[model samples]
Target chain A: MKLSHKELEIQSGQFGEVRKLALEHQMQVGKFFDAQSFVEISQVHIMADTEALGLAGIEYLENLAQYPDPQKQVWVPTITDPRGSDFKSFKKIKQNKRFVDLEKRAIDAFKQLNVMMTDTCINYQVFMPPVKGEHLAFGDTGSSIYANSVLGARTNFEGGPSALAASLTGRTPMYGLHIEQNRIPNKFFNFNVRPTNFSDWGALGGIIGKQMNSYWDIPIIYGIDYKPTSDELKHFGAAMASFGSTPMFHIAGVTPEDHLAQNKNPKMNNISLSDLNNFYKSYLPKDDNLDVVVFAAPQLSLNEMRILSELLDGKKIHPKVSLLVCTPSAVKVLCDKNGISKKIENSGGIILEGVCFYNMHAREIGEANGWKRLMSNSAKIINILGGYGYETILNSMEKCVISACQGKIVK
Target chain B: MKENVYFGHIGIGEPVKGEALVADDNFSARYDLDRINGNFSRKSHKLFNQSYVNKILVLNVAKGGVATAWMFRSMKISKICPKALLLNFANPIIAQGAAHANLPLIDRFESDITKIIKSGDIIKLFPKEGKVEILNEKSTN
Candidate 1:
């Protein structure tokens, strides 16, 4: 699984330990496959959550600290916090000293890695989209699949291997996503109506996920004319994958390769459409009513922040309900830099750092706050909330803003 | 009373002393064992917070051994530490009659059927469980 001499020494000056970790982690992964492991990986896309890993999170930076081997891996550090997570919550982690010392050890490590640190995974708009026949190694599960299906990039939910391979030996299992001939469409979708609202996207996504379970298919979704926001897309992507284990999808006009581009429109094997009655029967749980509205799972994008700020300008949050927003520190810092944070803060929404409603285990945060009827401007938050309570509802950022201002669902 | 079967390595045999349990593969044991419905990690899970118990746990398949074996050993060490004899997630099940395999505190490891099948049909060619069990292999593969 070793590369040519030139590739082996490609990351020499970057950060030695960072280099070692990358080689170790990725090569170890390479050993799993019988053949073509090192040749499989091409490009790297990072979807980071440093706060979650605490000290160990630095291990990621350590790996990133190196330049990638050519003739092998090209890495993209997708989104990261502007600076990095504050060392406060991370100080509590007991298992990692290497990571705790990251500030001193790895600031140089990040300098070596060539990937961009865009702080937002909710939107995959910043970088070059993976081409029709390319195979990529991406970490964000939703994005990985989205890139694979919509953008026509090839990748598995193969994060650890992809990340490691890019860092160390710079390779992957070529058997899965690397092959060009294997990149054809799988599932065919016939939409009943164009999804015009954020919830509409989620509604359609929910149906698609259920339709394609544990399989990869090309779903050509028709009729999605309204402008789709990042949060809406993230929600739809997560829900479709969570329930159905579906890895990829295609929205006729939105994705890189249209379903029509692939060898003629195959039969609509998987149907993803929404109308008033069926959307309710399929998406809205009988028990869902809406208690509180939560924003930020991957955290809200900058545009979302501005929209929310203007919406909540003069109104008070529902006296009985609560509105909470969690943004990665990087975005918060940017907002702080631009004064967007203060706008959101004055508008009555708290833009906290580190912890999010999804990964956090304490339901008390959701329950103790007395947000029995949960509403979300975010689809990611809505998906996680769906795990614990049945009353959660998914809505667009605009609808949520109005609800927050009016203190009710329809205000 | 419907005796709920927890097919995980969390609490395998010690429960056998007086507790009830069953041995199954890891993937199904984890995924098929729904949390919201309280299948494996039901109300009794209240005794602990995590979904699965500890000690003798099942592997993803007695083979295709990746995160299953070591993770269960980890679970047994702390996360899902159970009260009884440890059960292993093995194929041609780890002869339940074996004694040391049921040691109250020792974590028994087993692999899933899929792995064994995928790795090879010639069973005799496989590596020893203890040897494969020690690997902290990276995920790049």
Candidate 2:
């Protein structure tokens, strides 16, 4: 890859050993992708929860953190994704102290490196929304897809190590979605039906994702009668990225880059209502007894929190069932200030801040609490928990709320 | 004893030899694995419940979340990782993860790797050379 003078300096350790190591890692990835050069990135989001980091990863960070040189700090604004455990409510979910201790160590290491602990996969929604055509290195697949498709910002799915590397160097390999020609749609989909709720939108994304199950295949969707809200697209993109490693998508009239698909004739597929139903049918409840009803994965937006809060009002949760709601710390602050958190808590639900469920040592916690059957309105979460030894049920938020109250799957 | 060789794009980590565990399915460290038990745990996956430890995993492509980028290193630290990854195609997450973990990974083969390679085939991978060689042919049973 062609390196600028500053990049060459960083590579030569003129900055610091930490920055030089970061550049070397980026160069290795860039060479694998055959990236021609480095693109300066405006911001970066790192997704290194303690569960994923393990002891070695934390040690790696601590070694980098020990470098006290100002040049070792991140060159661009850097933030974080959801942590492994929510300190205040981890015990409520049966996550033990060891996990929290690891989390604290990871946080301390990040702080020493001058990284911000935004702890959100929904950073595009809650924190800073990237402008159109901006270059960024975003860690979470959901956030990367949303920024690329909905916001028209350019990014590939920057993982934890790569994102941290980019944070230190303030640039990433100029490959994948960073280039304009690659952004054009290669596959087309026509929607026969519009999504009614967030879950339906997620199902739509799943159908399309399963069809175009590749990082290289970009799908251009058509026939949406109305503009979908940001929260709706959040579930849609999150599920798509989960089911398929889809980096970016285009909605013919809805998304900003739909015009890029105008002159190309890509293979077309139609997504029908039956397709959505079949996607949901694959996750049908086995016996209806539910242990947990979670509303997370991409974490909740303020609007989703308000809707969930109202859903729980005047209702009591079943003593056997646990309803866990996860949101970013920023959104949780707003929820607390606006009584959304209190309303949900009063109805026997637990609100976890700065933590998403799947990454929070999910398998261990499930075993601890004997949580066998899990239900969630978020299609992304349901898709993920299967490997963690839970029989996941997918449904709408209202139905999920009803199931939580009754401690069973609602028909 | 005839050996068949195939070439791919030069990849990450050191060259190594291991028994191949081939599948036409895609992979994700977070979505398709029980990392604690070192097996393919997702029931829908073709290699469901199969142990992947110390084997060369030959798959179609990489899929799902960015957690794989970190999970690979974590799995390596715990001594519960595949010997190497041989995919027909790799997403950035897999490539980045293999780099982070210093695990051998080679992808973008001239042919479908999963079809050409079978489970239990003794294979040698030369990542820097972008080459994979099978030492034994399938026996007629």
Candidate 3:
């Protein structure tokens, strides 16, 4: 990957080993195609959720910190899931001054990058509002799917810290779905019928993602049987992204992919009815009897917290139910600043970090504790961690919270 | 180019004739496929799919190396345990470390202890190709 002359000149200005790596990475990325053909990013946000490699992550952050453009907005989720965070790694480290200096360095980077640094993924709606067709580099799995599929924001499924790198560089390879030609699904889902409810819609997404996970292909939903609710879309996106790598999707007339409506002989698998049953059976496990419920592994958004707060306020979790709430690094601060964290704490819940139930192996805790039924509002969590003896329920954050209080699936 | 064995293409080894529980990543293994019915009920999914318990489990990257070790420690390894192997594609030096860290339980399957091999090396061993960079373990931030 040869760096163009202009790119080489820009790479010269970067400081520190981390920033230098960021430059090298971008330059190597630059060689991928026309150097000038960069993704147009007006504002940038970095969703650096917790991963196991601390030193490597710090380096990744260092690269993310050195944003070439000062105007780019940035955000980083702080330590929300202590359980999932490499605690063993934390204990083993000889605690260098560099370790203590990590948070401050992260703060400094955020300040320099003008980052909004919120740990909450659900709150993207409040902290930032990306219009349809905006290209921004963000890494929160839920936010990534939400931004691209729901909000119509465009970005690839960036991981391995590249989202942070893109935020620092303010450009991603204008390839894949970032390119318009790719947005038109190689496959089309002809749905002359729309579902009447939310779960059905999400179930539909699960079906698609499962069938296509291996293909790395996107499908345009031609006729949705019904308009899915917020909860429905959330799970649908999570399940689809989980089984398959579907970063973005189109509902025919709803999204940009509608243009392919008339393309005869569109590539598709036409999901058989049995496959739909498998999709439901795949994520929505049948055992609903449970011992506990969990929310906030990657940290809950204000909306999620709001629902939990509203549901659990006057209510008490079943005596046998042990509910745990996790918030992101940013939300922990916001929760502190606003008092939402206190509310959950007062309700006899623990506010831990691990982004989602998938974080820190909390689902393992449910299994170990003999939780027979597990419930959550996150599609990603369900899609990723749906396999325990526990019955997994896919519902809105609101319904999930209510169910937690009542000790039953609150329809 | 023909020498590399990409994923999705079936490998040439004598098939293990067992219930294969395949997941794209650790979380999916832990969450999506453990239940016999349709609900969430468990303290943890360290071991999912009772049917595959002593069968064969092919895991992808598990939270770097530490989680891989911890995951194995939690799940009991019996005589029927599936062989574990860390997937080390030939690329940057950083990823080799990841693959080594990803499957700490690889050596437990004494009969089949094949953990770290370059992507190109897989062709000599398995002879199928489709680009098996499943979890993108290398691109960790």
**Best-performing candidate as measured by DockQ:** 2
lDDT of 3 by residue, A1-411 (tens): 344453454467533344345455544333322244555465544443332323344454465555455323332322111223322232221222343355445445555556554444554444675667888665544556667777777765544344545555556656555666656666666653344333445566666765552222667776565455554566566556654556667775455445644567766556555655564455454445555566743355555566566666666666666677766555566676777766776666666542444544344455456665666654445544444334666665566667776667665
User: Candidate 1 lDDT, tens digit per residue, B1-141?
Assistant: 112111223222222222222343322222232332333431222222333342222222221101121122222333343333222333111111111123232222343322222211111111211211211212324
TM-score of chain B of each: 0.27, 0.95, 0.28
Per-residue alpha-carbon lDDT of model 2 for B42-123, expressed as tens digits? 9889999999999999999888899899889889889899999999889999999999999999999888999999998999
TM-score of the B chain in model 2?
0.95
Question: After superposition, which runs of candidate 1 have C-alpha atoms over 4 Å from their true positions?
Answer: A1-35, A39-43, A47-118, A126-135, A160-165, A223-235, A259-291, A327-342, A353-356, A360-364, A367-373, A388-391, A406-411, B1-51, B54-78, B81-141
Tens digit of lDDT per residue, candidate 2, span A59-93?
Answer: 88888888885866888999999999899998899
Per-residue lDDT of model 3, residues B1-141, tens digit only = 232223332221222223333333332223433322322222344333334443334433322111221122123322222333232111111121212222212211111112322221211222122122222222223
Ranked candidates (lDDT, high to low): 2, 3, 1
Question: Candidate 2 DockQ score?
Answer: 0.81
For A332-370, candidate 1 gives per-residue lDDT tens digits of 667789878777667666665543544332233444455
User: Between 1 and 3, whose lDDT is larger?
Assistant: 3
Candidate 2: share of reference interface contacts reproduced: 0.78
Arranged by TM-score, best first: 2, 1, 3
